[model samples]
Target: MSLPDRKEAEVRRMLDVPHPAVPPDLAARAAERGRRILVRRRAVQAVAWALLLAAVAAFAVWAAVVEPWVVPPADTTPPLDGW
Candidate 1:
């Protein structure tokens, strides 16, 4: 047989072989690992949200104390004061 035919035969042989069975405990182990990862992710997200809320509160307090929304009066240099 030619090279192509030989490669096809090899691939067919490989495909015909049965795959190995999974270990009985593998599913349980995978579920436990997934839960651990999920917990860590949620904890990190919670911390990030708390920090954001803290920053917003601090800004609000500072704004209330400073009254930044009020506009300052215009300065005309005291007309005729130096005359």
Candidate 2:
């Protein structure tokens, strides 16, 4: 085949190939899926933040409300008579 004829044949073959048509609801379905994913992601983030906040609050409450240190009584040993 001549170069021009080969090129024409290639073009014709490409043009003749049928493209699959997208469904009418494809965009809507995709948008709905994306929204669901985003909602789930946001919910997870919110729960994580809530848990973290609760932990911090609990620690703060423990630190403020509970005095955990113990003080020893005064030492009773007598001073030495001579240095």
Candidate 3:
């Protein structure tokens, strides 16, 4: 048989076999695990947002106190002030 025909025959043979029985509580168990994962994801997102906000507030406070935009005073005096 050709390669494609052999592959098709194999797939047909596999499909003819009976599928295994699933557990009755499989859906419920999967749903419970999904809910737990969602709760954890939401909690992590909330903490991340809170930390981002706190960082922005801290930077604002630091900038206000330090005033980085203003020029600093010169170190040496001019030479001809007295004459």
Question: Each candidate: what lDDT?
Answer: 0.96, 0.92, 0.98
Clashes per candidate (backbone, < 3 Å): 0, 0, 0
Q: Which candidate has the highest TM-score of all?
A: 3
Show where candidate 2 strays beyond 4 Å. 1-16, 66-83
Indicate the TM-score of model 2: 0.57
Q: Write the per-residue lDDT of candidate 2 for residues 32-76, one digit (tens) a residue.
A: 999999999999999999999999999989977775565666789
Evaluated at residue 38, the lDDT of candidate 1 is 100
Name the lDDT of candidate 1.
0.96
Worst ten in a row by lDDT for model 1: 74-83
What is the full ranking by TM-score, best candidate first?
A: 3, 1, 2
Question: What is the lDDT ranking, best to worst?
Answer: 3, 1, 2
Runs in model 3 lying further than 4 Å from the true structure: 78-83
Give the Å error, residue 46, model 1: 1.1
C-alpha root-mean-square deviation, each candidate: 3.8, 6.8, 1.9
